[model samples]
Target: MKRIPIAAAALILVALGLGLLDLGLLDLGTPDRERFRGMVSPRLQSDKSSDTAPTIQAAGPTYVGRQTCLECHRENHRLHSHHGHATTFRSTKDPEVARRFAGKSYDAGEPFGTYTYHVDDQGLFVRIPDKFGDRPFRLEYALGHRSMTLISLLPDLQSDQDTPRSDRDTVALEHRVSWMASEGQLGKTPGQHDGPPQTAAELFGHRHEGRIMHRCVYCHVTTGEIVGQQIVGLTPNVNCEKCHGSASEHVRQARTMKTPPPFSVGRVDWDAESELQLCGDCHRMPRDITRKQLREYPDLLARFQPVGLLRSECFVQSGGSLKCTTCHNPHQSIDETTETEHEQNCIACHDETTPSTETSRKHTVCPVSPTTGCIACHMPALKLDGLGDGFHDHWIRVRDDK
Candidate 1:
């Protein structure tokens, strides 16, 4: 881990204040949160605070939740609240979840069949009349923001109060259809096959056993214990502690000590490789995917940003200078950044004025249209298969036949 210079940190703070550093290059525009008002606020308490205290001791860090962060990091907290990470995971009971499905039914066509959504006093449910007859599966959780929300069917769960199912052998569904924000309607979930299903679970959605289910929720939520195939004490969404680590001790010292430690807990020093690994925990690193996937399905790499980014000449040659944080502000949504603002990062290294022969020069200057269009020419936005949206190719490179 490398520490950012104090001068550079100060300049970044100033740029942030002046709106110079505000940028989100991943996805444009914010998720529709109007329907989610008063519905999607993060659960303030960690599971360890109650019955899971013993598990916390075994697990290591004691998470204090994001609410404690607001006491000092007000601005960061405010920005992160609107981020996609904040709303990635939420209960199906969220008002928007119900409203989106109100009087809505999606005919998936053929063997997959039609799916209908409805809300009742009990909870939100999706009924597949063609497959399951009149029997409906209650939608337990949502796996994404408004952009595209994948509904979960937790048939094994005891109740909808938030805790994981008790049984170790329980299974869940990832739902065949997801609410595509672009279409404003339910559509086929990504990676689903066009061929007919071999089983009942295949007819509805992707079936996940214990380990798979735990992973699906683990990445979305901040902190949770994988107890007996169940992720208990779950904190919805990627709140502050997700990256900052457990902050209970930090908060305690802050309040009790007159002269608090400069920085006792959480990560401070970060290099390009370390930051890539940090973000790659969920976003998929090169190691996460097969070499065949990268070669055969290059377009799919658009979603696996860290994978493509690590392969990029920019990251490979930057000497650990270029990384995820170079263009993206982790706390803010990607929509906050414009293409021009993002191009600045390119300009920093690919300086047109810096001669190739100069000893200080380390990067090549773009001979063609250097001042602008860096993103459009180099890292173009690609529409992935099955996904109704586009993502900027993080493999920053020139586009000239090769």
Candidate 2:
């Protein structure tokens, strides 16, 4: 018998590993349920005022803050507080802050040093042993939902309650260790552990300055003006205005005039491609990634739903009908959405009764496990390394073999 080449053997091993990971045979570590339960639920109300509106609004529409939206949409506002997007970014000042960092320490080992966390009257702080700096770095922002919280040491700026800060390019650090909701302890942050630290900031966590820093805050916040390198007049977390676009005019017209003028709220049309672009802004889309990357390591891209979904046959042949909202409710937390509901969404498009064929019908039916296991069979959860849990592959297709 001929022996397989070294590279070929390596490839085979990798494929086997990926298959096992997809099946969740490997123990990446389960989230600490008690710790996850400790997360502070997002606040229902925002201190809405003209001054609190996003200084720099998106090009098309102006933001009016989620508070103004509550006047009209009370129910949606209530449900949105439970969503991961609503708690994506927050200051450490409040008791509702996601995780308490006090009395936590982890030894990263080797080139990376030990990281220690503590809370004081001022706020939470991290101490990283490094040649350049050994002082406790104040963690001003917590970025993530219940699954994980990344600690960010932001650039120092003078406080002026009345005026917005002038934007300027500055350095910031994302701590190497993140508060893992699963483990309930500090762990190596995803996407930060593999490569050698190129800069001092990277030693702790990925460095952010200028555009990078603004990008970090942009997705987490509902709306904010990017002034040079700073985000001013910011509203933290995803809210009604995040999806519905700026409703300042809509609110104004409704209040002042008996009949509100026909203000076209963004996402009303909600076309497949347009919705892909909107959701992809943060979830990541095909355009945001390269073709080579997607083709070479499709499993890694599973974390990004839009990227995978865009490549799926369903989105391609659905004739502009398919959208992220097709299966997902933007206002509700994903945890609330059940597997049964997702399977029903599959059944809605493809007839389970008939055999899949190249017929006049737009979609082919599943031959095996028709009504049930639609999501498991087609969009099997693929566990990406470092993400801790399996994310259902949005690239919907037949996967008979593991």
Best by TM-score: 1
Instruction: List candidate 2 segments past 4 Å from native.
Output: 1-62, 96-98, 129-134, 149-168, 193-202, 225-230, 256-270, 352-362, 400-402
Candidate 1 structure quality by residue, lDDT tens digits, 1-402: 122232331221111111101111121122222222112211222333556535433444477889888998899999998888998887777887777775688898777677888888766787777566676667777878875555453444323346545534355556767888767777777655456654555555655544555666777888675554445898989988776556665676689987654442222333455556667777866656665665764676688788788878887765666778888888989878888898888887788565654333557778888788888778888776556556888888877743
Error of 2 at 380 (Å): 1.8
Q: Please, what is the TM-score per model? A: 0.76, 0.73
**Candidate 2, residues 28-111: lDDT per residue as tens digits?**
232222221111111101213334764333233457688777887788888888889889887776555524567767888766
Model 1 collision count: 1
Candidate 2 residue pairs in clash (backbone atoms < 3 Å): 31-182, 32-182, 56-225, 176-204
